[model samples]
Target chain A: MADLRINLAGISSPNPFWLASAPPTNTGYQVQRAFEAGWGGAVWKTLGDPIINTSSRFAAVHFNGQRVAGFNNIELITDRPLEVNLKEIAETKKRFPNHAVVVSLMVEPKREKWHEIVKRVEAVGVDGLELNFGCPHGMAERGMGSASGQQPDLVEAQTMWVKEAAQTPVIVKLTPNITDITMTAIAAARGGADAISLINTINSLAGVDLDSWNTIPHVGGKGAHGGYCGPAVKPIALNMVAECARSPHIHIPISGIGGISNWKDAAEFMLMGATGVQICTAAMHHGFRIVEDMIDGLNNYLDDKGLASVSELIGKSVPRYSDWGDLDLNYQVVARIHEDNCIVCNKCHIACEDTSHQCIERLETSDGRSYLKVREEDCVGCNLCAIVCPVEDAITMVEIPSTELPMSWNQRQKAIGSMGQNEAPGAKEAV
Target chain B: MSDYGLFQEEKNRLDAYISRQFKIVGITENLSGATVELEHPGGGQAEVRLLTAEGRKYMSNLVIKQFTAAN
Candidate 1:
């Protein structure tokens, strides 16, 4: 088996799968259960001063029979007293000595409060600390969670304070609610954060019940926007991870968290520069046992790829991610229909004729048999025909000769501007 | 206008076919000849260089046939 173990910013884990700080990691018992289920680590739910929570603190949206495609939560950090959470953290660490137990912490923005919390959590022998700069709903209003996370300066100052008092490595968890997440990531690095975990949930109103006109998971017939997570947020989370991975300004280990459901999802995040990926909704939906497949599958994937370990997969695809202008505009592909595989439902034909470019032609052969063919010259390679085709493997996109050479828009502009000529040539010189 | 004509007989059919099939962006007439700019179906602009009588006759016939037959 390929080595699945990972040492992220000095905090080592048996594997790269960690339970995100959520309901799944709410207590020592829950975390111990997770370790038993084969998770390498768990960031115990955010711990701080106790607070009263609403009765219905969670709401979820489902799509195509998938439970909680997007999950929303109004739940605050751990409601248990700080001492209780601290004691549990110690107990959990003692029980799972090899497993990573990073304490998630949130406290007043004051320097002393952060210092005090960091010291207490570190004293428990936890592997590391993740600054809960991200709970985006009820906690931000109190200027404790996302309020500080949204501001880079605040993230820097708070992280600095925690780092000053903490013995363990600090992982600054970031909020997705911010305009540019990198700003806060860079700030955390400046403040001496050992690692970064993202993205904390997005601010969302789950949905309103049309009949009752009430927000979902209504707290006493009323509702507030909560933090959104789960499957629907994976694309957003992946994009953020890729951006951070590509940027040289922020150099820190990333613990990717948002809508990761399986080992494939974990691999994508890892390839995009996350050292480990913390998961919540899947564990919430499928229980902690899901990590069994996550661990085995990742090991199989690494072995199949001829890689030695999970660290080898990290940031492997970062070089391929780039701006739109950097993409090769001259690269072209056209749709090709397979006569043998085509079901000929006329879906692709009709779609191309009415909605997209009218490039498909239904031709009658010499034997009075009719079949659809693409007018390649007019195809545009838009894939509209392929998209509307019901049959799999019926239509395939084939690369064709391009009008331009291998050059991007950015390169084209540079070539034009370098000659000290104001007026650039037309089509003749574009390539 | 007829002095340098190549396919004077097919001009009307080609014009009707090209105009009905594609959107004409602009036509520029330089000292050499005319360049008819037409919007490509996918995106961007495709220029038909009618700089010479032969060039005009050849390109117009090819594009007109391609568009009209596809329809």
Candidate 2:
């Protein structure tokens, strides 16, 4: 067994896994069951002035059979009465004393409204507060969600107001719609946010319905771009986390969100210096019971790698990440496609030819059958084609021998730069 | 089976099978050569090699398995 407990801002959890503020934590009953099932905490769904929630509120896209690759929603902040949500939070906290229960809040952009929400939530025995400034859909249109986050100054001022209003720790959930994440992060840190979490989701149109020529989740036969989250957003979320971690002015702990579906995804977030990983889409796609796999997977990974504690693995790989110049110039690879067992699908060829470098070739058989092949010279070894290919044991990127090719781009750039400087046509310039 | 013997057998089987699949100037194991050059069936050259010990182990184990591209 590995030590999975983590202490963030003086609040400790049995594990760093917290249910993101979503439908799973929409009520105390839902959250209590989540804790019993081994979740470390639950950020009770975003609470605001009670409003009407429409029927048919969500739209989704599926990928690779069982996974929800992307998710969108017209859903607004918590529609349940504030007092009812508060009562549930208080009771759940009383029962699961060890688990963290942070309440997610969204309110009008006023000092009085925010101050009142903070005071009321803290009295319910929550360990912390995550200001819901990141919801990019319905609430944003109302000037309460991402609209507040898009302006850095407003994010700063609102966070400070909450800090003054609440005695417990406060986390600012940031929107991904911003061009620069560091600006918002720095603003939150300046405003006294104990931590920062992202990214609420990106505004996106999942797809359009061709029959009525209308878009999906059509409210009155029209659809707006809703916040996109799921496995698809992991890379974008990861880059933002690293940016915030690397920023000198923003040193607060980051609660990584967006598309974390498994322990490996969670570990990747932690390695990028996230204090904890918050998840929604994975839970929404599968169920809260998936947390068990997350717990066991993380524990087994820690044990197998000889890591004594979860903390030891946090941000362990951040130092190895660096700029392009930091990469070893000598490293190289070539794409390999095994011929005998090839299933003759042209996915690899289409991916390489259409999207990536013109590297893959398709060969025809005597019986008019054709299979995909990789061209050596053009293949930059990006592995995008291989990653997209569905067949197992199909395509692999093998490292090129160092002596086979001299520093390719390196020597070429050097040669091109010294063309005019050289005394003779092919004369070598002194270093 | 010993690792060396296993590597030798797998390498020999792959060399023979690939030789028959694509028309090429026959395959040879030049352990003395430092480079791994792969000649594509489509008149292109790839000068890449499996460098690390871990990579060689993975390649040896999976070399003989069948492969296919997805549509």
| Candidate 1 local Cα displacement, residue A172, angstroms | 0.7
Please write out the lDDT profile of model 1 over residues A47-116, one tens digit for every residue. Answer: 8888889989888899979788999999998888888888888999998899999989999899999888
In candidate 1, which residue ranges exceed 4 Å CA deviation? A350-355, A362-370, A384-388, A401-404, A419-431, B1-71
Candidate 2 clashing pairs?
A230-A259, A343-B68, A400-B48, A400-B49
For model 2 the local lDDT of residue A259 reads 90
Worst 10 residues of 1 chain A by lDDT: A416-425
> Model 2, A388: alpha-carbon shift in Å?
4.2
lDDT of 2 by residue, A240-346 (tens): 98888777788788888989999999999999988888888888878889999999999999999998889887777777676564454446687889876567677
DockQ of 1: 0.04
Error of 2 at A106 (Å): 1.7
- Fnat of each prediction? 0.00, 0.00
Clashing pairs in 1: none
- For residue A139, give model 2's deviation from the true position in Å: 2.1
Model 1: fraction of the reference interface contacts it also forms: 0.00
